[model samples]
Target: MEYYEGSFDSIVGDLVAGNRVPAVISDEEYGWIISISYPYKSESGELLGYVCADISMDSVVRDRQNYLLSTLLILAGVTAVFAVLYYVLFNYVFVRPIKRMSGAAAEFVSGGRDGEFSSSIATLSVRSRDELRLLCDSLKRMELNIREYVNNLREVTAEKERIGAELDVARHIQSSMLPCIFPAFPERREFDIYATMTPAKEVGGDFYDFFMVDERHLAIVMADVSGKGVPAALFMVIGKTLIKDHTTPGRDLGEVFGEVNRLLCESNSEGLFITAFEGVLDLGTGEFRFVNAGHEMPFIGRKNTFRAEKIRPGFVLAGMEEMRYRAGVLQLNEGDKLFEYTDGVTEATDAGNGLYGMERLERVLCAHGADTPQEICEAVKRDIDAFVKDAPQFDDITMLCLEFRQKTPGIKEEEQ
Candidate 1:
């Protein structure tokens, strides 16, 4: 009973004092042990020795540890059961639908271009009201729109190709309509004649023609219709045909244009008009009789060097009914060249928004004077090209050049 020192002493003191010890006390030798000791009393007021009971703290801690381990095992089993249930629920509720949408998307992308669209998404869409359903709706709308656009695009492309083919044939026909042959007057070489025309489009509105009306009169025509493309080309053909038809021997150049204008106005329903300049050069006397109907001034020279010939222009052809044209006479001496062109020459624009004005044309036309009519036309073309480098052609460019070699006695030029 007295094995423990201080704790036993306190119990004994309590018993001797006749007081009750209520608290557990610890001892070093017992590790984690506690004891309760109290005083014992006899019935005759006699004092008895101390009686105490002890319990070890080690057992309490062991019981606590065992309880904690059991609690943890129960919690672990519950947690495992709930984890399996949640996995199944999540896969059934969300993952399965998502996978279906994903598979549909992949299939549509792989075969969509062939005009095949998937209808499987609708099933999932009707089954749910979540974001997945909205995604399916959006995909359907997108593919439908794309399909419509693709169909429309195919139709437009085919139509464009057809129009392009027709225009090509038209361009060939238009080129053939004019006297595109280099040696325009091959056999009779009273003077050398060469002309060129370049349309801004595949088919242009500008046209040039040189043909002998008789043994003495060589008629040259340079005209520009009001517009471009098929309509302008049609009008150009009509105007060209009328001018050539009305132009016969013993007819005044101005009167010929007046008759042609009347014929064009008869069918000018589109209100389209033409600016024309035509001249008849007398091979015998070297006298050129020309008429200008609101056309650009001609450049007069033998070679590349030239000057603008001033003229009082009449109203444009088909502008009004029964408008009279005025004729002008200019003598083309031997070795003298007459260059005629449309507005496309002086009115050319550059990339800098600069007009290739008449000043530039004169300067370029006067430089590097060549001997032949063909060389004169080509030199001016090259100069215009160089001046307007990389700039798009805005209008039809047409040029005609003729050199008078002699009067009554025609001089032969080397075939060029």
Candidate 2:
């Protein structure tokens, strides 16, 4: 091997010493370099040796470039696929719900009724168990709840209207039961009487009536039932009728009250009772006999002064089966006035939770004693309203007033 190497070097040096051009030639088998001399020379201007370097990069450079190109193409394709999938998912799950929700919100804002919100975006099954799905579910449920609430509100409002209508009818019927026409008998100049009732609610249990017992006496009655509404109204009717039936020109006031009390107790079912004041006025003598049944004291106005008359009150009717009553008498001179009322007046409460007590009522009566019966009643109502000052009325207020007049025999003859 050493001799061969030396021989090859000597030959290459002789060729390159001749100033030859070196050429590298390669083939599939192996690679080598050849040197060719331009002019033949031996000692002068000759190359020492041919210089050559040969290397093969067939596996390293070519294979690496091809591998890199293939990797880049695979990565681009994968990225494209991922981007397409993301686009599809975003449109189906996110974009679709957002669009539907926006449209629904717009419709709701444009005067849509409660039923319009029933439609939901939960039908899209793309991302069924994710946050977006839960959001959609919640929205659907909220819409359902809102719809149900609105329906309930409407039903409540309708029920309230129905109750209000029934109450109105009840009020009309109750008012008809009383004497609404004023000046009941305008031509009977022997006396002037008037009464009024203002109920806190649509219907009340306060009532008043006046009727002539033959030609010599006048009957007046005022009552307040224990309860309110239809039951109390019915009781008031029974009480008034019973009292009127027993009242006659010569009938004793105490006997009339006792009989009425016994009759009420016999038929009373809910333990209802009444506080009543009944009176009979002799048209000729101006003498009044009255009975109080657990009622308020009466006020008499004479010579421009009003004072509460102390009268003994018997037991409330319809509560006891064997109750007794007594009568009290008062002689009313001509031009004398009498006032009677229910406890609703004195018990009226103000905004400050203060009662319009007996003292205030007396003051009101004295202040408006000279006015007509209607005017006096109005004055009392105004004072109550002023005192209450936006507070709710809790009971029925009623009032009755009477003026006595002696019939002149000569004038009656003249009229006849």
Candidate 3:
């Protein structure tokens, strides 16, 4: 029954090579079998005798099929595990953070700038310790910055509106202080008078007025105060009041200015000063007596010709105490025009940086051909516009004009 005797030599050959030998044998009891012989080695790898085992042909085929099935099942299980892990990584690292940021941005936009729902921007949980976390931090910071900017803009707009309202009120009060009514000195047949004051974009202190001191003498004033805005306006009120009060029936022109100057210097805490021209015209004899306080020269027009007068200028009022002013006299015949203005008129600038000086003013006056005071003023203003078109107004322009008609007939009594 022992079957190892026939294959002993070949088994030894296989063992020497340290390999397995497989052989087919026919046995009467087993009916066709396969024999496998393997070498046995000691701990030092020294080969010993071979060991042989026999299996029936049918059983060998069955074992091979079972092994194939088990291998396929194990491989499928491992692939499924990897697929789940890949999905988790993609969702956490890329998809989830993007979705959360998109949602947050949408909500922030749909809500108003001051909406309380903006806090959701900071509540996102994209803490992957990677780009997702960095993106979250940046989004939160941007939201905070936007909100802060909105708040600051609101504050600035409100402050601007408040200041604008106050300026509007101030502008109204300043306009009221001047003589704005057209055809000033109505019901006076001896002369025709008109005056205008245009303020700068910022409020300015320039004023003009003409009033009858008595039945025959007309007082005319043109003045400009230092600086601008509310302070200049308040100072203008004081100056205007002082000038009117000191011009009485018996008061001299220079002496009136002298007293006003003293009073102004005492109250000028801001060191402000005024350049002014005050003149009184006698209706009967056509004598014009005037005093200038460092102001611009007046223009006289006769028979369609205009010329600047050669009169001396004195120190500005409120500049020094006890400043003395002198009166100058000029004779204005019938149909003669006297024009006075602040520096703003001559200093008007165009976009080309050119000044509207005395030459242009004289040309404009002559071009008018001896119009009424109102028409002359309008005509000159048109010329100035043509010269300085589209230029930003740099200063306040004030102009006063008066035309002398024939002397009052049989008015020897009105002169008193």
Candidate 4:
């Protein structure tokens, strides 16, 4: 208190300017202080020494800081509570329902238990009236449609299987109708004959037959119908029966075909026709008489080679009424063979759509000309297969071979 000496420039300046100013001051003991300074003047307001008052500010500042901290903590607590509430509400409304739907879809697609398909999505109950509920309903409807489709598919599959079984039986029956037994005339040693028929489909339109008309006459038939499959097979049966029944011992082949053509025209309601050739060989003299109706020419094997024998073809059987036919004769010497076939051998195709034409057929036939009748037929088939190479068969292939060795001993020689 005695001789207080400290720098008071700001206080002095305020006092000289005759102002009362409050200011912040620092002290070692009080830490922080506020002061107000003023001039102590005479009663008439003359210049005089100054007087000042100081106050500590620590308690006021501390109280204000505590209030702000309390306010911030309360706000943080309120924000956290709102956030928790929002999460629960959102999960119940959207996330939980979505998770349930996903699980149901997975179960259904994974092939649940026998009765679980209908119940998998149908039992998902979404309480909210939103797009998710609509989606659930859609899933249920889809499941129902799938079930109906499966039932219909099963029925269709069963029907298809039944049809396939019937077709298989039909194939076997058609095969049995042909002369499948080799060495057909086993007891006779005067000649050897062999033939084969392979259908492009389950059944074929081509057929061949050989039967002894009498002790001296051997009749052979080779024919191809206009179409294929069941209808063609039925027509083939009719034509075969008609021709065989009309052919009798010593009956001229031309007259037999003429009569058979009339009979076929009367019954040809399906507008079908046949390309046929029939030949009668006399075992005593080797006189071969044949008639052709819109069919391929026969290949004659002689001198260890094969050549196509040219013949004028008449109209196809069942083409029209009163179509005349004529018989062509050939003298078959000893060791000569007759090879007959359908157009299938020539028209066979490859993946490149190339035809296995007559040139190729003749080459193959001549290559195996010296072999037995059965071996010759098999060789031709193998060559055709090699040329076609995995291509689908589109037509029926049929072939017949007849080798007239010599007349039977003790048989009367017929004059040719």
Best by lDDT: 4
Candidate with more favorable, higher lDDT: 3 or 4: 4
What is the per-residue lDDT of model 2 for residues 94-170, given as tens digits with 9 covering 90 to 100?
88877777666566545345444434333433355777767767766766676778779889989989988998898
Quote each prediction's TM-score: 0.75, 0.70, 0.72, 0.74
Candidate 4, residue 24: the lDDT equals 44
Q: What clash pairs does model 3 have?
A: none
By how many angstroms RMSD does model 4 differ from the true structure?
A: 7.1
Number of backbone clashes in candidate 3: 0
For model 4, what is the C-alpha lDDT against the true structure? 0.86
Off by over 4 Å in 1: 1-126, 302-304, 410-416
Task: Using TM-score, give the best candidate's number.
Answer: 1
Residue 24: error of model 4 in Å? Answer: 15
Clash count for each candidate, listed in order shown: 1, 5, 0, 0
Tens-digit per-residue lDDT, 1-416, candidate 4: 21222444535666787666556465445565666576778888886866878777677678878888889999999998998999999999999989998888888876644543546776889998889889888888887887777678778989979877887898898888888898888899889999999899888889999988889889999999999988888889989988899889888899999999999999999999999999999888889999999999999999768999989999999999999999999988888999999999999999999999989999988888888899999998898899999999999999999998887668643453
Model 3 lDDT per residue over 1-416, tens place: 33442433546665668876656455455565766677788999888767877777666556877788888888888888888888898887899889989999888877754444366787887768887888899999988897888778778989988988888888888888788887776677889888988888446888777788998789999999998777887888899899998988757889989999999999999989999999999888899999999999999988868899988899999999999999899999989999999888888889999999999988888888568888888887887788889998777888988999877677766553
lDDT of each: 0.83, 0.78, 0.84, 0.86
lDDT of 3: 0.84
Candidate 2 has an lDDT of: 0.78
